[model samples]
Structure formats: C-alpha cells, structure tokens
Target: MQSTPATTTTKYPDKPITVIVPFSAGGGLDLTARSLEKLAPKYLGQPLIVVNKPGGAGAIGWGELAGASPDGYTVGITGIDMLLLPLYGSAKYDYPTALTPIAQVAASPMVLAVQANKPWQTLDDLIKYAKKNPGELKFGHGGVGSFPHLLGEMFGQAASITIEQVPFSGAGEATAALLGGHVQLSFVNPMVVKEHMKNGTVRVLAVTGEQRISDPVLAQVPTFKEQGLDVILTNWYGVAVPKEMPVQVKNKLSEGFKAIITDPEFVKSMSNVGLKVEYLGPQESQTKWLADSQKLTKTLQDTGVLEKIKSQRK
Candidate 1:
C-alpha cells in the first residue's frame, strides 16, 4: 500500500494584518482603531497594525483601502464620510462595490450643541431664533461634505430655517471655533464636547439620532424626532476589506472584529471616548451602508448639493 502525502491547512492570517484608519492619529476613529489593535490579536492569533492615512477628508485613505489587494490582509475603518465623499465627486472608489463590509464597530449620534452661555435653552429656542434671523446664525462643521455639514443642511431644511455654515479642518477645529464664539452652533459628537459639557462650557440642545442617547451627559438631550423635527444622522464606524476578498478570510476577519467590539473591556474603552459599540455583521453592515448611501444621495440631490458638486466636477 502506498502512503498518502499529508496535507496541511493554511491559516487565513498567518501574518500581521493592517487596519487602515482614514483619519489623523489621536482622533476618535484612530483611538477606536488603536483600541481594537490591543484586542484583535487575542482573537485573530496575529497582530493587528493600525495605519493612519488621513487626507482629502478621508477620501485619500479610503480610496487606498478600496484599491488595496483583496487578500483580507488589508482593511480599513470607514464612516459616513465614505458615503458622502463619492456624492461630492471627491472619492476615487465607490463603497460596497470597491470594498467589502466586514463588520460595523461603533456609532455616535451627532449633537446640536452651543456654547453653554448661549442661552438657547432648547432646540425650539434655537430654531425660533434662526427663523427670526435667517442666515445670521453661523454653524461650524468639520468640512463641506462631512456628516456635520450634511446634518446642518438637514436641520435647516427640516426646521425651515436658513443658517450660515463655517467649515473647519476637522471636528477639533470646529469645536475650537465654537468655543471661541466664531460660530454660534456646531453639530459635533457628544464625546468631543463632553468635557466642556461637564465644565459647563457647552450645552447640547438635541441629538440627531432616531432615539435619545444613553450617555449621562446627553440623557436629557432629546432627539430631533422627539423635538418634532424629522432628522436622524448617526456617524458610524465599520471595518471593510477590498472587494472580492475570499469568503473564509472575510468570515475570519468578521469574527475577530465582532469579538473585539462586543468584549466588555473593549466596549467600556469605546464608551469612555463617547463611542457606543453597535456591532453589525457582514450582511447587516452592507445593507446599512447601501441604505445610508441612498438616503444621503437623495438628501444631497434635494438640497441642491448634488447638482453643485456635479457642476463643479465639470
């Protein structure tokens, strides 16, 4: 009898995996990725390296991720900006088609915040004032095509108010501008303004999620729906690999990330930074990405932003 040759199965991640973050280091997304870096290795059986490739309002880094080899070794942290970038004619690749969703990690609702001394008191007060003084209220946001900017537009449309917008480099800069009174309002993350809230330097009027947030500082802050305005914008973060990644490799990556996002310590760390762990598996992530993209596309179109971007592209 002839002896059969023994076969050995190759591990999906025998080498280090690189997780790209499309934001600058020390930012919320980067911090979240760093947190996962510490936790993923225990489940992945290999080290996870976080690389920051921030530029072009996250278009540069996300485009790189979309174009990377579909071997599952390279993946990235993507957010709502990824969906907005292409609508603005700024992204090099389309999402879900250029990249495969692995899993959603965290989500943070946008807060309609003002300087603590502003005296708006409530979402109704702010809208009433904006209605009386159209375009007098200047709102600061991260940039032109960012989620904050979109939320600002949505707020204005839903409330039938016209307000000016001041675009800054990033949320930190926008928050700084708001603090200095350069802008009266800002749609920022609760975590970004939480410290100020504790010190009574900022007052969050309302959250832009479908439901009220559970954060202690924001527990009293009602949602737009609760305030009688139909607006919901959640900034979500997720992991995605290049399109066409092998099924087994995708499953392995998804499993590792699901474990990391749901781990108690990991969840606590993310919460400390104002991010809530909202894990969505591959199918759910993809579905949400597509749905959000469609919704935002219609918003841009209805608001004339899509037309403006198209004309600019020409």
Candidate 2:
C-alpha cells in the first residue's frame, strides 16, 4: 500500500516531501530519486523521502501521485510514460491535466543494438539487410505501445522497410534476447548495452533522439538523422505534483526542484548513471508535455498502434 503525505501546515512542506517512484528499485528513476533525496533539504527546506509503488506499467505510482493532495509536498517522478498511459485504459487519470509539472530532469536516449557477431556494422548495414529480406529481421522491445516498440515501428516507416516486432516483458528482457541471439535487433537504452558492447557481445548502430547521448563514450554514436533516418524518440523523466496548488506554493516547489536538478553535483550524479540532466521550468515543461502528447498520439493513431494499446489495456 502507498503511504500518505505529511499533513499540510501553515507553511508549505512543514514536513518531509514524498517523491514516488512508479518502478521498482535499481532502475533509472530510482537512481534519480535517490539523488534528489540527498539534495532536497538544501533547497526545499525539507528532505525528500522516496517510496516505491511498482505495478501496472507505472499506472500505480502515477495514479497515486495524481490522487495526492495539491499541497506541494506530494510530487513524484514522471516520464514520457505519464503522457502515454492515459491514452490506453490502463490509467484512469490524464497526467497532463491531473498534475502540475515541476521540472524535466533527465532523459534516456534510445539506441539500435545488435549482437556483435552479426553482420551489421552501421545503420546502413542493418537497413540493407532489412530491405533485402523484408519481415525477416525481428526486433525486440519493452512491450507493445512502449517507447522502444513505438520507435521500432516508426523507424520501419521512415526507412521504408518491413521488420517483425517481438515484444518482451520489458527492455531488460528484450536486451537479453538480443544478447542471446533470440532477435536480430533491439531498441534499448544505450546504458543497457554499454557493458555488453565492451564485452564484444553487442554492437550499437544508431541513436533515435536528435542529439547523441551525453556520456563521453556513447556520444560517439551518430543519431538517426545523421544516418539519413529522420526519427526522434526520447524517454524523459521529471517531477510533478497534483494540480491546483496555490500559485506561491507551486512556484516555490518548482524553483526548488529546478535548483536541485541543475546543481553541479546533481548533474554529475545523473551523468554517472547514463542520464542527461536537461532542466525545463514549469511553463516550458508543460509546453513540451502538450507537444509530445500530440506528436505521439498522431504517430500511434496513424500507425494503428494506438488502437492496439487500447485493446491490450482493455
């Protein structure tokens, strides 16, 4: 069960603030929350306590956040999934409307990876093989309607190719499948395959987002656009509280979170874990939320992927 936030006092956050992680411990968001925990007291006047509420593909933790009191002490970690889950029946609340965005902290760049022993040396190499044998090359992803899966389908459209989709329980499983030669390709987090690449078991071909990753080693990999495929997909993380807070309280919380996320130490902490800290304030974050929501919705609807996700949730 989820724990309740401390009671609201005459002043905001008279007690510790709760930052919820929808996923289990040891994941990217968990690392992010732990970093914030160390930095919160200096900024927010109170420490942040992290609570794990994993289940239902993030619907559980986010749902709890949306239902939290709008008293400025019940914010939680958010992601691109926050906007996508409501489109399906999995989530009862729309994150954009139900919660107030505080700041965008980090993003995970997607990469196209293949087993090292495979014949693909570059994005072009993989494209040529896929064109030669349409629907013969299979790629693994977190699941249907997931960012990695959606990116895979969109890539085929942009590159004018037909490849098979093989969904897994999550990106970790999908990456394992790639390493074991169960699939020809996988769109996974760059960090997930970094160690495998070092061990000469995986070869990353191209990145999906506009920029290369911030990691010095991963930054060398060219983006999809550089390789002639104009596809951009990003998995971003942020902090948000329930909506309709007093204006002053909202601003205070927002500014505090911004300070913590952009601090030099916070930046270094995120960098060590393969996350890039890109801080966007409340207004800018909301603009991005609406833009991403529209773009992804159109992509899913056009490709009939939206209906598949809706059906799966039902």
The estimated TM-scores of all candidates read 0.89, 0.84
- Residue 94, model 2, lDDT: 85
> Could you say which candidate leads in TM-score?
1
Report the lDDT tens digits of candidate 2 across residue range 170-227: 5566777888899999887776677787788988889988888767767788999898
In model 2, which runs have C-alpha deviations exceeding 4 angstroms? Answer: 1-11, 131-138, 180-184, 311-314
| TM-score result, candidate 1 | 0.89
Model 1 C-alpha RMSD vs. true structure (Å) is: 4.3
**Model 2, TM vs. native:** 0.84
Clashing pairs in model 1, backbone N/Cα/C closer than 3 A: none
- Please give the clash total of every predicted structure, in order: 0, 0
